[model samples]
Every structure is written in structure tokens, then in C-alpha cells.
Target: MFNVSDGVPAGGEPVAVTFAAVFVALFVAHQVGDHWIQTQHQASHKGDAGWSGRWACVKHVLTYCATAMVSLAGLAAVTGWCPDGVPAVVGMAVSGVSHFVIDRRWPLRWLADRLGKCPDWLERGGGLYALDQSAHIGFLFIAALVMAS
Candidate 1:
């Protein structure tokens, strides 16, 4: 039988570095993908007016930065450099799931309807992008913790 525990030592610098690098790479990739999507959306929309486009751009940039920070914190905890593991994992997972759901334009559309508002393209796009970025960060954090352990 191939035991997962056998692959890792109790704790080590190698695991820490690997975990950090992987998490960071995943975050950066998400940001890049988000930016690409936004650019495409802009091109397709062409001459749409109002603050919606600008808001979407700003929201994505800010969300990406926040996600990166959260991922880093989770990575730090997983490396044993920080004293918390479960909380970090939980936080990352929550953030990740929220991101995924939001990006897919799920419950948000329903909520907006309840408030008597239609779902705009910007709202849908921004939610989907944010959710995806969050999911990536969460998955990377979980992977790092498991591998480090």
C-alpha cells in the first residue's frame, strides 16, 4: 500500500519552500487569467457606458490583491512558521468557495432579483472572476497543508 504520510517528514524547509512557491504561482496565474477575461469582456462590449466597466476593473484588481495576501497567510500557516493550521485552512476554503460561487453568478443573481434589480453583465463577470480566484487560492492552501504534513 502507498501511504501518503510516508512521503513527508515531520517538518522541513523543503516542504515550506515548495508550498510557498506553489501557492504564489497559483495566485499569480489566477490574477493573469482574471485580467485576460476582463480585457476580453471590454473588447466585446466595445462602447458600453457607465461606471460598471470601471467598477469591474477596480473590483478585480483589489480582489486579486486580497486573495494573494490570504493565500500567503495560509501558506505560512501550513509551513508551520505560524501557529494555526485549521483556521487558516478554513478561512482559505471559505474564501475560495465564495469566489467560485460569485464568479459563476449564482446566488447573487437571485439576491439581486429579490432587491428588484436585473443582473448586469459586469456584475456577472466580476462575480465569476472573483470566485475563481478565491477557489484557486483555497485549493493551493489545502494542497500545501496536506503535503507539508
Candidate 2:
């Protein structure tokens, strides 16, 4: 899956494939993460009242946008789309692992600690949030390879 030549157009720029992969992966990540938070953890609205809750949601969305931008920048660097010749496998591995560690595990733990709760839906196996997160990471890794190639 990491093979660049597999998906890249012969002698053409590889930006489109890479961009698509990133977008898809990020969407998957959000779906899985949001589902986990909603079903399992009970969406913790940080503020009181409808307006406040909406504001909080907006803030959360902004945070996610920032994360996506940073991930893309890092991915571009690791893929050597700038420097060139960097090992695609290494780039994929790094991005995947970092996302798993930082986004899922760490944030879940932190939110649980701060909010005084863990995802109850996760215990029920309603939609396989764990698998979703894993798949999201895997997709990002594959996307990185496709882009790099």
C-alpha cells in the first residue's frame, strides 16, 4: 500500500492522490472520533445554554482544523515532497503512529480525566470505534505513501 508508483500517474504530479487520501483519512478519523465521543462518552458540552454549546462546538471544530493543517504540513515534510528522497514507509509509519497516539489515546484519556467519564458506548461495541480509529490511521499511512510516490 505504501508503494507510490502503484497509484501515481506516470510522469505526472502526485498531489491529487495525496490530497484525496488525506481528506478521506481525516474524514474517517472525525467520524469515528465523534461517534465515540457522542455514543460512548456523552457529548460533554463545556458551556451552559444553547449559544454556549454552539460556541464550544465551534472551538472544537477549529481545534480539529488546526490539527489537520499541522498533520498535512508534517506529512508533506516526511514525504520529502519538499526535500525529496525521504523513505515513504518511514513517513507513513510516523504519521500513522503519531495520529493514533496523539489523537485517539491521549485525547481520550485526557477528556475522560477532565470530564470524569469514559466512553460507555465503547463497552457496548455499537460501532467499533476502536477499529474506526485504527482504520483511519491506516488510511492516512497509505495515503501518505500514495502521495509520496
Candidate 3:
């Protein structure tokens, strides 16, 4: 949960600006983590049906979170902005859990199916990745808002 606060913190960045920056940081980190940082093995296998797939997803998520942490810290250092501890932790947990759930892959497919998206479309093309990344971005918005608070 986010606590209400003045738009500007000690660093003097308004909440709107901070939220935008935090969202950008999270989004960029997400792209890098999911694309560049993720191992080919993880990408290929994380969605498989087994403990192995679970392990790969877990490993990928760990690195993804690390990249996000580094990105946020770097942003803070460069901008002199700081997030509160509780909200920051809550936000990260939210983001991390959401990422893990989404990367498990089946959840998104199931969701897409339930929502009436074509199953073959998800299987054959960029549909799954699009849904996956969009979910991540949606959660990132929540994370950024909480952190900015």
C-alpha cells in the first residue's frame, strides 16, 4: 500500500515526474532483463511443464529483479531522489511476484484464452510476449506509483 505524500520529496522532484521516471526505469530494466539478461536456456525452457521450467523461471526472475534494483539505485544516485523503505519494498515485491507469475507463461496463456484471445495466435507468434510484456508494464506502473509515494 502507498502512503499519501506531498508531490515533491526532499530531492524536489514532483510525484508526477518521479512516477514517470520510475516507470521508465522499470520499463527499460524490464526490456534489458527479459531480452538481453535472460539466458537463452531460460527463455526457451521457463514455460515448460516441470520443476525445471519453474527453476528456470525463478532464476530469470532473480536476475530481472537485480537489474531493476540496479536501475532504480542508479536513477536515485544520478537524480538525488530517494524512495521510502516500506513503499519501495512493497513495490519491489509486487513487481517481482507479478514478474514471476507472468514469466511462468501458462498463466498468461490461460488468461488470454479466458479473455477470448485466439490460442493459436498465442502459440504461433508474438502474442504471448506481447501479453507478457504488457502485464509486466501494467504492474510496473503500480510499482512505480507505490515507490513514488
Candidate 4:
């Protein structure tokens, strides 16, 4: 979907600018929300084997979504690119669901196995963390595209 109207990326469209801005804004917010805003309890318990774990993950996702929304608001405040309506809703929905699924931890592990990533590397090395961050950024790009559209 990386279409260009001119010879350059995004073709200098307002929507393209919005997409780039939204992606960067959300990336910054994701870092802040996951690392700084997420609580120790949530981080420790989110992957546990019970409702408590699910609840912890839910709380984390809630706060994460809130952080993202605030970041979008801040973007609007500075650049006047107000994103609303169905596109924004759907974009955030995609983000929230993706975040929740990934934070559960098992889904990623399962996917890694299915993709034939070395289990030892996934567990012992930084591969899983790198995969997790990359996945989040990939989904964020989709969300930003939706919002810009």
C-alpha cells in the first residue's frame, strides 16, 4: 500500500503526513506506555495462568490504549491533524486487539514455533523481545494507514 503520487514516498499528501506523524507518535507512546506507564504488577502477572493474568493484561491494554489516544490528541494539538470517525475507531480497535493478543505472550510463542524459530533462541536470547517490538510497530503502521485513509 506504499503508493506514491509523485516521485517520492507519500507524495507529500496531507494524509501521508498524517500517517507518518501518527506512526511516530504512536511508537513513542507505545514505548512510554509499555515501559513507563505499565505497572510492575501488570507486567509480572499479565502472563500468569488465571483470570488474574487476563485481568492484568486487560488493565495494561486499557492504559496502553489511553496512552495512544492521548498521543494522538497531542499530535492534533501541535499539527492540527485531527483523526476521528470510523477510520480512527477501526485503527484503534486494530491496535487494541493486537496489543492484547501480543501481551498475552502465548500467541507470539505459538506463532514463533509455527514459523520454526529456534525455541531456545526465543526463550533464552533477545529474539522474542525483538519480535514483539517489531510486531507492534508493524501493526502500528497498519493503524496509522487506516487513520490516514
Candidate achieving the largest lDDT: 3
Clashes of each: 6, 1, 0, 0
Candidate 3, backbone clash total: 0
Task: Report residue 93 deviation for candidate 1 (angstroms).
Answer: 0.7
**Which consecutive 10 residues in model 4 have the weakest lDDT in total?**
1-10
Each model's Cα RMSD: 11.1, 12.1, 2.4, 4.3
lDDT of model 2 at position 68:
50
Superposed model 4: Cα runs more than 4 Å off: 1-13
TM-score of 3: 0.91
Arranged by TM-score with the best first, the candidates are 3, 4, 2, 1
List the candidate 1 regions with Cα displacement exceeding 4 Å: 1-33, 36-83, 118-149
Query: Lowest summed-lDDT stretch of 10 residues in model 2?
Result: 39-48
TM per candidate = 0.34, 0.36, 0.91, 0.89
TM accuracy, model 4: 0.89
RMSD of 1: 11.1
Model 2, global lDDT: 0.48
lDDT of 3 by residue, 1-149 (tens): 12345633565556788899888989999999999999999999888889999999999999999999999998888877677899889989999999989988889888998999977878787888789989999999999998887
Which digits, one per residue and each the tens of the lDDT, describe model 1 over residues 1-149? 01124565344445566556645644564565456534565433322334664455445545554655555656556644442356445544544455434443435455556766534643655753444455556665764454334
> Relative to the unseen true structure, what is the C-alpha lDDT of residue 111 in candidate 4, on a scale of 0 to 100?
94
Total backbone clashes of candidate 2, pairs 3 or more residues apart or in separate chains = 1
